[model samples]
Target: MAQAVELPDIQFAAEEAAEIQQNIISVYEGLTGRTLQPADPVRLFLSSLAAIIVQQRVLINQTAKSNLLRYASGIQLDHMGLFQGAERLSASAAITTMQFTLSIPLSFPIAVPQGTRIGVQGGDGSIFFVTEEYLEIPAGGTAGAVSAVCSSPGTTGNGFLPGQLNVLMDQLPFIQSVANLTATTGGAEKESDEAFRERIRTAPDSYSTAGPQGAYEYWAKSTSAAILDVHAFSPGNGKVTIVPLLAGGQIPGQNVLDAVAETLEDRGIRPLTDQVTVTAPTSVPYNTNITYYISRSRVSEVPAIQAAVTSAVAAYQLWQKSKLGRDINPSELIARVMTAGALRVVNAAPVYTALTATQVAQEGMTTINYGGLADD
Candidate 1:
């Protein structure tokens, strides 16, 4: 009998993937002062990537590829070229044109999600959700493509340069995480009520408040140190007051309330209602302090969270060093590095040629159709 050809152990499975993802998210959520939703893996990854860039002071043009990699190591960019063209302005003069291009490759962290066969609507008047099909990736494949264009009037005797238009494309890592989560059929992350409370207690910061009136803003602004503010009143208490601080956008307030309500309800909090009331025009004062006590609960988890982040980086580094890793292409590597997110590949090519001398003059006011030149 022939010996069985054994495949190497894929040590990381769905459970491990989720834990790793959550761990990464914990770092992001802590830094951003934002609550993580069950389906927030992609958003968190993108936000965190942006945060990392911000931290490194990598603003446009001011920074380079190597600098960006300090924050996100999975992808790298190389400037391809800056092409310049010229057109004749006079018998002896020519106009000049310029174009620039860039190429970037993203590597996937794991097996890419094959698109599923999703269902639209049913024949009957009913709703339905169906998987289309699983997405697949070519073995050791690279996804490469470029898109960009620049055009301007030919250069005149007075050198005038148009502003550089930046067209950038970035991958959405959060969507990838969601796809992975969806693929994960049924396996809950393990944590008891006490454990959960402990996690919160050790978090960099935490605070509670009653109602959307203002608790959400307060809690998000406050650091990781748990600060529990138990509100004694509910909506329509006349004591309800929610002033708009960073209004117009939804943050942690509503989500926090939902999380708390779920947890409290689980613990048998009777008919506890959490609601927000937007007062009618000229109804009342529209602003009430609604006194609620905020208490700093704890701050024990910061160290552990930091430690986990370090460990994850090390693990990824080791994996990259392995022989098997060498087989992965840049795109695949980018995909893997930005786990729980979708990869957006960007390619840049010179579309418009630079303006020439004659082209430049033609584009200028040579005819000068003004009153001063109107056969005066």
Candidate 2:
């Protein structure tokens, strides 16, 4: 995986009080032809003036950094993206398929009113879904499924597993049960400054129409802010396959894949000769079985060492699966645990396993066993 964009600390104007005071004293001496020593009254007065100058320079530095992609944020970042016709994405509502079942098959189509509210089991069927077009179960059919959007936008309505939402807020005659068939997904918060800045930096890749690799990457990511990594490659002629990985190593479900596909399949955006396909990456499972010991000299700090080791292991798990095609390297885990003040560390599972560009190494089970205190 490539490193994130990093810009060195930029000083548009010096904000240090000591430096400003020295420069001011030098100018005062040049103008008045006087030696300003530590006991000089004018030098003491210039100290306060230098403090005021420092505040002005702080504002100047902030204004300067706001123009660069690596440092801009909020409205400043938005303005930079406008040069390339890119805009920050707003929060969006999650979506799911609501299945409404009737007690028995009806000779005529049973109406499932548009915007019928189906709440989770505990919410008293608080009508969550926004309005949808009219849908009805076909004649002689006992059930039908229609797409539903969350009334509340953003991730507030996301992550509802199948069947978790089974209560029908609105009572309709002959409706036996109501539940969500698919997991609620696609809800996302507004794009963050870091995510939007990267887009603005890569926005130039979209200028060409020849189906460049960067263009495919930009288009795939533009579909959703949930996407963190995109790998676009061509296995053969005129065929392009793109694999997108979400944040925190969550694999893209069918709904997410469909959304990416739709975004890349636009006729105006896609070339006539190119055939694009969107797919999820394969997941390779790995287990974390670690046993670590603490040094006897650090007995008094045993609690702190154990806490640090736990945090280290958790960080390693996230780093391992954060990117697509990351290898399963137990050595990385050992290094992290050792750095966290462990005297000795042993990992039983997950030897180094190589992965293809389209496969992700996911953790299955984690067992962190402490081996008690030992000699240095």
Candidate 3:
């Protein structure tokens, strides 16, 4: 069987003006029984004039074709407000929990006002604002946990550590210091043109009155680009369960879960009878132990090789997590390790118990132990 050739939506290729003028000259010469050379003054003038006229027509045609393609495919659409009539979902900011510790116990509760700025150095230097008006630090308690969100929408808000959030605003001195207990997650960059194009391309076939499985999955992902993976399941009639994982493969926090649920509910796309429950997947941590054989001549490159292998393993883990319920294949991971410019993979043993039905891979949880190279 022959494969079908996929053609571009719009035809933009055009013959050059000079080429068109040459063809016209060839026909004219044949009719007049005269040879027209570039050096001939009359022929040169006519050819130049014809080429310019042809060039203007070509530019007009190309411009019209480009506009038609953009309008038809909707590739040039910008901002979420322009998407999916009446069901627009805006970009979301990353949110995380921050811990505040007081140097000494106060006689009364201390209030950390809402919109208090807490930040880390470098990167986007994004500041996280307290979600509520007043997060109280109880008397005699040295520590308190409060929710905070990024000032703007993007992935730069994620990954702050405990000591990194040292900056605090004036008036919060009673709060002593602030730090993030958990990795700041759920931050995602704005959607790209290609990603939105794919969604629009598939939109027609995915429409359903009762909210088909594909529709649910699509809408769930549309909630946020940071939502790396979404799994929708219906065990029985009128029951829908959604599991969303973050970009780094860990389950999303409560804020993300709530946002997804609210979007689904507000969209009214799901059938009224269906009971939708949005939740995070259980985390399954995996580690690796590998022993590689290195050539005696390149013993000094051990550190570089080890770093490459570790990076490879980390990438593999992310790929595995992107697809929910996929088994962790040891052989595939070993292939990744061997491809890191190593002399030979003498032996590789990945220590991981396969995930259960409701589990997803966790990021920064995998540990790769590189057993010293066995000189060959």
Estimate TM-scores for all models.
0.14, 0.88, 0.63
Write candidate 2's Cα lDDT for 159-275 as tens digits. Answer: 888998888778888899988888887777888898888877777888877888888888888988778788999988999999999766778777778788999888767898999
Candidate 2 residue 30 C-alpha distance from true site, Å: 3.7
Best by lDDT: 2
CA deviation > 4 Å runs, candidate 3: 1-91, 97-114, 119-126, 130-147, 161-183, 193-198, 295-307, 346-348, 351-357, 363-376
Off by over 4 Å in 2: 1-9, 124-127, 130-133, 295-300, 338-344, 374-376
lDDT of 3 by residue, 1-376 (tens): 1123466665455557767777778878889999988889868877888777687777766666644323332333543324443222356677777778898998888877777777675434436545444588888888887777888788767666546665675457677788766666778776655455445544543466577766777777788878866778887889999888776675787768877898779545778898899988887665555566556677788888888987887778778777676666777777887888566664344544577656775544454555565666
Ranking of models by lDDT: 2, 3, 1
**Model 3 poorest 10 in a row by lDDT:** 79-88
In model 2, the Cα lDDT at residue 137 comes to: 88
* Model 3: how far residue 29 lies from native, Å: 16
